[model samples]
Target: MKTINNSSKALLATMLTVLAMAFSTTTQADGHAKPGDFTRGANVWRDNCGRCHNIRDARELRDDQWYSTAFHMRMRGGLTGQETRDVIAFLTSSNKPARKPIITDAKAPTASSKASKLSGKAVYNQTCIACHGADGKGTLPGAPDFSSAKGPLSQTDDILVKHVTDGFQSPGSPMAMPAKGGNTALTDADIRAVVKYLRSFSK
Candidate 1:
């Protein structure tokens, strides 16, 4: 059995990208399509996509465009139908433009005041787990280790939530985490939940 080298993998990824672009310019909706889990898709993406090349920024494509591209990738990457759907979910969800909170309600929870209906662990699994890993030690290079006493998790909740909301690049990380971990749908409360959850990693 012969193993393909990194250069071979890189070449393959490039070819796949070219093929994807050639595959379609129009969005085709599938009525029977099953929605993929964003978090699972993130895990699939992190664990697999980088094997071929540097991961493309999710913001580079429209959600509809991602559907076609993800399908193309599915064929080339030998991803399962479910995995393909998951990747599509991850791509489409991760790419949306960030929306700032419009607080018209006088009773809205302030950023400084913490409240969340979603559990911190739930938020972490959904948004933060892809890069941060389940252990909080990080799955990507330069991702902060949550278990470290002096790491990002040790920061105050206010700082952590702000960072999650605004996005941040670690000193040596090859890539920066997108705001709200690329889930613009996440609320201030969700960020706070994940932040609080992540803190437990250090303790």
Candidate 2:
């Protein structure tokens, strides 16, 4: 009876050990982004999508427009379906501008005041015209013409800002836009002003 009791105790101990190992493995796996992990979506965007497009601010497109653009780019850009979805989820969720409080005070600048005062033409001349041309037509192989009717500027201020800040590398383009036009110092306000300026040139 003593031997049998010892054997049962050993078996129970083994079972507990197995269970513990299984639980540990699961916990570790959860710590990382799985194929479906939206939590890791931002990282994925930074790694993969950020190479070509801005990923931080959402002033570019409305949520619905982002959905379509992401899906189309996923196919043309060779992103896996899961990766595309992850990036889309990140952009749609985190890129929007914050809503301002309603205030009756006369001192508050209207929403338009929040818009940057810098001229798009000045910003372009200072930074972009070398690569994109004075007309906002891209001069280099990888650069895109902002004047193109089909370009992102035709969308909205929100969409343009998001794209500019995130950076984008189209498949055929040899060079990609660096985040914030390769001027890391450019503030979000600067990018918005540039977007507004570029839209003025669009057909």
Candidate 3:
């Protein structure tokens, strides 16, 4: 093959640089929306279903049923392809009956638990914002309005933490919220951060 001239090499380098920049921009835009993360899946589930459907029923369906329902709901719910897969993964994993009895008030995780370095705002944005809107008034009917004077925020931190850790249903809400908002990977520290962040909305 003929050797490239200096000008040709410079032009090729410029083109390669442009391509790299475009790729980097695309990756940044994608951010943490990757489909396989249990956390992202939990966020997607809350955004799509928590507003209208009962999130506590994930265990009631088989894997195939979850798959079928996710696909069917994708268009109606406006789920991206990534979100559809993520929620399916969430449902599949969540469906298994726990062999060990669930502890309602498991103490704060020790050094062995999965730890989160995210600050309270970051944690709330990732996990809680989907159901609880940015204003903390709640995005949908069943979610408690954190901004209300007598709402969930009025409770002491310990009660709020326990409710989030163990799952809770408001007295008249349509359904119960799943523990750890269905991420299941949250540590007590993360839950505390989220509770703290949510408290900011009321104050």
Candidate 4:
């Protein structure tokens, strides 16, 4: 009787341990994309996704595309489920169509005024400064050395804009330049402004 009781207790303990481990694994597998996940996702994106290429705008892809891309990137970037989910949330939100301006009939700034207000430095600071240093010297391993005359900054405005608008992976380099610097909010003019800002580094 004593032996049987001991055996039973040991079995129960083992069973409990196994159950706890199973629960933990399951929890990790199905991560929650709770509120504010996008904010976390942005950090993950900056840390992991930015290493390879320009952090593409989240709006560049569709909902399903974001899901698939996140999955693919999860394996590539070795991202956890929670991180992947957060990135998906951020990307999907960015992809949503822009809402039309409200018809409040209130006075609005003129197009020229709005255009004039768009500063190249502002766009660079907001978007490009994350990977590229303030001096355009580059903060990452493969980032172009804008301060170097032989660097990518030597490229023409059209080429620079194209690279800025679309991702570019240079030969013999492990890192990549992400399209639009991962900020989907930037317009074509914004990209042009950033390109102009980059040119200032070469002069």
Q: Which prediction has the highest lDDT against the true structure?
A: 1
Candidate 3 lDDT over residue span 16-75, tens digit each:
998987777643414435556555676788777856656656666888998879888887
Report, for all candidates in order, the number of backbone clashes: 0, 17, 0, 3
What ordering of candidates by TM-score runs from best to worst? 1, 3, 4, 2
The TM-scores of all predictions, comma-separated, are 0.73, 0.41, 0.63, 0.50
What lDDT score goes with residue 42 in model 4? 55
| TM-score leader | 1
Could you give the candidate ranking by lDDT, starting with the highest?
1, 3, 4, 2
Whole-structure CA lDDT of model 4? 0.70
Query: Candidates' lDDT values, in order?
Result: 0.80, 0.61, 0.73, 0.70
**Model with the higher TM-score, candidate 2 or 4:** 4
- Mind giving the per-residue lDDT tens digits that candidate 2 earns over 1-203? 43558889999999999898777763332322444333344445545554676433334667678767767877766776566666666556544433333772366655343555567667666555645667777655556767777865556678777777777665567555545554444556777778777876775
Candidate 4 per-residue lDDT, tens place, 1-203, comes to 43558889999999999898877773455435343254456567668987787667555678899888999999999887788887776666545543334643256643422342568998887667756778988766666788887888767889977776666766655655545555556676787887888888888
- Model 2 has a clash total of 17
Which lDDT tens digits does candidate 1 get at residues 1-203? 99999999999999999889766744333663567888889888898888897777777789889989988888888887788888888788777655555773356756434566678898888788888888999887778999987877667889888888877778877677777888766878888778878878888
Model 2: CA > 4 A from native: 1-117
All-Cα superposition RMSD per candidate: 9.3, 13.8, 10.4, 7.8
